[model samples]
Target: MKKILLPTDFSENSWNAITYALQLFKNEECTFFLLNTFAPAVYQVEYLLVMPQPDETLNVYKESSLRNLEMLKERMQTEFSNPKHSIETISIFNTLVHQINEEIQDKSIDYIIMGTKGATGAREILFGSNTVFVLKKVKCPIIAVPETFTYESPHEILFPTDYGINYQDEHIQPLLNLTGNNVARINILHVDKGRGLTEYQERNKQQLESYFKHSAYLFHSVQNESVQEAIANFQLKVRVNLLVMLNNKHSFFENLFFKSTINQIGFHLNIPFFVIPTKLGKK
Candidate 1:
């Protein structure tokens, strides 16, 4: 069984993500951990100095968190009513990233499915700060569903890479599992920016081709265009429902996301982003 962690803040964006997850894995046996973390909005000097007993404010927040989690669980059962899926609720008073790290270790989480933006996220922003932090910090594979994105079978997946890192079975298992289950076609895209692929990159590309020989995959390349622009151009040609990328520090993925603001990068993702981290810790 797959262990998937879902973090919610009781927002429509979050609900949309949860709905997507349930539908994506409706036929499979899976356990979903519904997590919500809360902390005081502001810290008072007295509150910080003394570790007081459960205060009224803390109690109120904790109670609300638990109530919302239970309600969410009930809603999932009512809507899906799937015997293959089991729901677990977790309510805690801690930072979102911190608690997520703990849960990943404690539960051996396989994946995390969450919204790109939170309750207070702006319209133009592609990802909220929390989402960005998790993508950078968490090692688990994460599927960031767009706020208004409804459920769609990922018949075609677009994977953009520079062929920098050697592909690993463990790191790419999630992608393989998704495609194996959905019978989806994987489009491997590489953007050529004046210079050609190095010998190392060429070897990596050959290895990837071998890896996907049994699967339905196509290797695509475009010249004189930025990675972001190439992605946009390819999407225009192919109807891709899911976007996959490996978060390698030396790869263009890092330069595209970590160095600049998500929205300002000129690529606004309407489809779900399936990001697989190369390893745990900061990207």
Candidate 2:
């Protein structure tokens, strides 16, 4: 069974992401883990650092978290009512990223689906602080749903790559599963530096094409432009529904996100971004 993690803060944005995930995998038998990471307020955390036992106020926070999670689960069951999916709610008294890391191994999570930024997060930051943290540290494939994005059947998926890493079926299994299982088209975008593909890159490209040979696919090559610009223009041109990218180190994915600000670079991801980690830390 596929195991998917849904981290929520009981916000409408997070609930929307959960709704999207459930609908996306409604036909496939899957287990959904609804996780809520509750951290004490600033002053309370400082106090807890000094005190061995959490005070009554801390217990109140824990109680509220558990209650909200249970309510959320009930809401999911009432609204979606999909027998193929199982909802498991977990409420932890820990930080967001830290708790997410712990659950990744404990639950053997397949995919992490969440909103880019939640209600409490500032809208000014392109990618929320929590999302950037998870994208950098977590090793699992993550699907970040933009706050403004609504549930739409993804007919066109844009997978931008440099063809630097050798293509592997296992690497893109998540993506291929969606496109092949459903009536979706995979659009592969490669930004070239005026120089054509190298011998190895050409082989990798062929291998990738071979993987989706039976499915509807299109490969596009744009010359002499930054990867971000190419993605922006192509997304606008095609009106892509989903954006997929492999987060390989020292690549465009890292350069685009591993920064203080994303808006400073003149591009903001408006669609759901499916990021697959090139390398995952061993459990």
- Global lDDT of each model? 0.86, 0.84
Instruction: Single out the weakest 10-residue window by summed lDDT for candidate 1.
Output: 117-126
Off by over 4 Å in 2: 43-56, 118-124, 261-263
Q: After superposition, how far is residue 251 of candidate 2 from its true place, in Å?
A: 0.9
Q: Please write out the lDDT profile of model 2 over residues 171-278, one tens digit for every residue.
A: 888787777556899999999898899999999898898888888899999997788888888977897989999999877788887866664664677789999998
Residue 146 CA error for candidate 2 (Å)?
A: 0.8
lDDT of 1 by residue, 1-283 (tens): 9889999999999999999999888888999999998777685445544653546768888899999999999999999899999999999877788789889989888889999853344444557788989988888899999897888999999999999988888667888878777879999999887689999999999888888888999989899888888889898998899999999878888888887566665457888999998885331
TM-score of each: 0.92, 0.91
For residue 112, give model 1's deviation from the true position in Å.
0.3
Question: Cα lDDT for residue 176, model 1?
Answer: 84
Residue 3 of model 1: what lDDT?
88
Show where candidate 1 strays beyond 4 Å.
43-56, 118-124, 260-263, 281-283
